[model samples]
Target: MKRPITTLFMLMSIDGKITSGDSDELDSDKDWKTIVGVKEGIGQYYDLEQCTDLWSLNSGRVMEKVGMNDKAVAQFKSPVSFVIIDNKPHLNEKGILHLCSWLKQLVIVTTNKNHPAYAMNLDNLSILYQEKFDGEKLLDELASNYKVDRLTIQSGGSMNGYFLRHKCFDYLDIVIAPLLVGGKDTTSLIDGESITSSNQLHLLSSCRLIEAQTLENSFVRLRYEVLK
Candidate 1:
């Protein structure tokens, strides 16, 4: 069965600048603890317990660059699986093995593995790999593996843009916090093409939360629907 693509986005500022008139760059850390907690809340609100067979969609390059490297495994979701897009021929075996075991539902989208590196590194993990490179096909394969009718996009930036541009995302949730980041090289919580096609989004809900006890501040959570 085919499932509708759902995307969720959460953004936090260094000084709770959700309505700041000026555009400020993001800071390092990106307030991950709060972000993870919000994601957990979303999973609970969505009652993922009834749909435990769902898998998360993400980019393999970003996963290798950040997900595996993070020392404190952010508590985002409970026992959720993932479907990642990675077609690199030189990917290491150790990384794939680690991710496959960690994620509940793991699938890799890649082209033919005919390279020397792939041949040598292919192992038990290779069994979960697929050969489709497009976003639509990737989602279909994920639905086949898990009975997913929705998707939540945890950003690394580029992957988010690709999915949104393809109109594969059907929902967006933004968590705004109080902070100002004047950093030069940092990135905002969300960035993408101007969405040339007229797409209407309806507001699903809004809530507020005290994000961090250590920091002692509140944040606004806004959920938007990418009209079907």
Candidate 2:
């Protein structure tokens, strides 16, 4: 099965943590604008005017944390479709449907075959399935059905770790912030359990740095290609 090229884009602290604390709130300091360069670099690297689809794991919480409420999401005018992975129906179906009616589409990827809300007819609501939420199969369906060639993954640690564990992503784009928040409960870019010697990601064999640059705000941007 053919799959769309996947890029995991994230902002991390100097110590490799995704969030400063246990909260999902992102670092919204003025210096955060440095992320624009990373977005531009992705567009240039992929030769895309704009990304085809925006993917998220538990995107509902992300939107809420980022100050985008149901009303705000409904007002979004971007052409890019939104794809969310919600194996347990963590998001509100009504809000998702409302947002989808105003956008290109809203796709919910779930393993639950008997989701009652999805069973009801909802306009512009697409439900894609996998028995156990296989990341590769979800990507294949996105490519085959939605024609998504370049998909951007904007997610927290758990989702990022899922793709990394499965080797589903192709590229990783990271923005290193200058701030450091040290906490044992803090989240990192990857949230899975510690890997043993056999399953560790060996940089030399698994990935290669393709781009590195300092942005105007003193943030460092790094891009790496996952070696296949």
Candidate 3:
């Protein structure tokens, strides 16, 4: 498949937890900022994120958890073209409009026919209706049709798992926080169906460490090439 060079970019805990908890209310953006030891170096993650690929992918669940649904913003513009995968229609019409106004382009990949994005008739907004979610095909379409060269995967763990399982991920860039959040139900970096047989081991991806840099306040930046 012809697709863009994809990078899995994220900020995760030392224990690999993406969220502070499993619930929608618990998010790394909110919870980590409140903690003393973890909050000190948290700004570094956002600072680094500003330099990532202009084309970014995120799940609607992640945006909703970050309160984009109720977020009030002034009329502004951004260079980033955002791709949101939403099936539950997590974002409302207002939120979709907000994103459309802010981003260079807002592409919504959804299975929901009644998705709020479909109602709005905006030039920046494009709805890619899918009968079933296919991460690999999505990337190919983004590259072929949308002219996306480098795509940054900033979606939730479930979407990350889909990319990982499909071997759609090309690179991994992570800012590992100093703290360790331990919870069996908490969201991890890779969450989905686990391999039960030896034949399924091919789904596992091995990383070739490209660089490991230590940032201030105990935060670490790890970059890896997904060894294909």
Candidate 4:
């Protein structure tokens, strides 16, 4: 049960939708700006520069949503290590290489044992293993090997749901924008296998709201601590 202090940081619409649709863009530019502003606030509040790990489940979609093009990617610099969770290692070698070029370290989490034996052999690349995407095991390895105390999970919905279902997340930092993108295909804040009746989250039992604030941009930031 040993794991790092994991936090889920996400931006969602008023209706709790994470993405507009299949597209890798938010509802509007203002929403995107609001997310960035909240992230900056988080950085200041938490002194995030000292954090060693930045995690994401969907790298391509996240990069596109954040408007990280090739030029932006090239100039991107961070002291924190980048950890990507991909069960199948679906990302192309070129893209992985590109990110490894800029990041301090690029760690790929995959269930596939042969992932590291592939063609790309970047300097700061490391491969970690987890069977069937075990969230707790992954975090334990991160905490023990990488010394990632405050790990951030900035990702799409399914991964968020995975961590929540596994009860591996300690903090949930959500920024709710003042807009709603309603569509059947729209992704929600947590999208994964349905939790059974026995395992559903109960208020004040599994989690508790610690902070709630309304930003100047009409966005509401809510922080919740998962009680173990």
**Candidate number that wins on lDDT, 1 or 3:** 3
Colliding pairs, model 3: none
Residue 185 in candidate 2 has what lDDT? Answer: 80
Strongest candidate by TM-score: 3
Instruction: Compose the digit string of candidate 2's lDDT tens values, residues 55-164.
Output: 43345556455533445345555565778776555566556655665667778777777653476576667887777767877788888998888788877677777777
Judge candidate 4 at residue 5 and give its lDDT: 81
Q: Tens digit of lDDT per residue, candidate 1, span 38-77? A: 3333333233223423556655555554535333433343
lDDT tens readout by residue for model 4, 103-222: 788788777776632567777888776667777887888778977776778767777777777777788887776666788667788777775676464422266999998765466778
lDDT of 3 by residue, 1-228 (tens): 489999999999999999898689788999898899888989999999999999999999888988888866537799999999999989998788788878999999999999988778999899999999988889999999999999999988878988999999999999999988899988889898889999999999999999999999899999999999
* Residue 3's lDDT in candidate 1: 56
Over all chains combined, what TM-score does candidate 2 have?
A: 0.76
TM-score of each: 0.59, 0.76, 0.98, 0.76
lDDT of each: 0.50, 0.66, 0.91, 0.66
Stretches of candidate 2 exceeding 4 Å from the true structure: 24-58, 67-73, 113-120, 199-205
Tell me the lDDT of model 3 at 85.
95
lDDT of model number 3: 0.91
lDDT of 1: 0.50
If both were scored by TM-score, which would come out higher, candidate 1 or candidate 4? 4
At residue 127, what lDDT does model 2 achieve?
Answer: 84
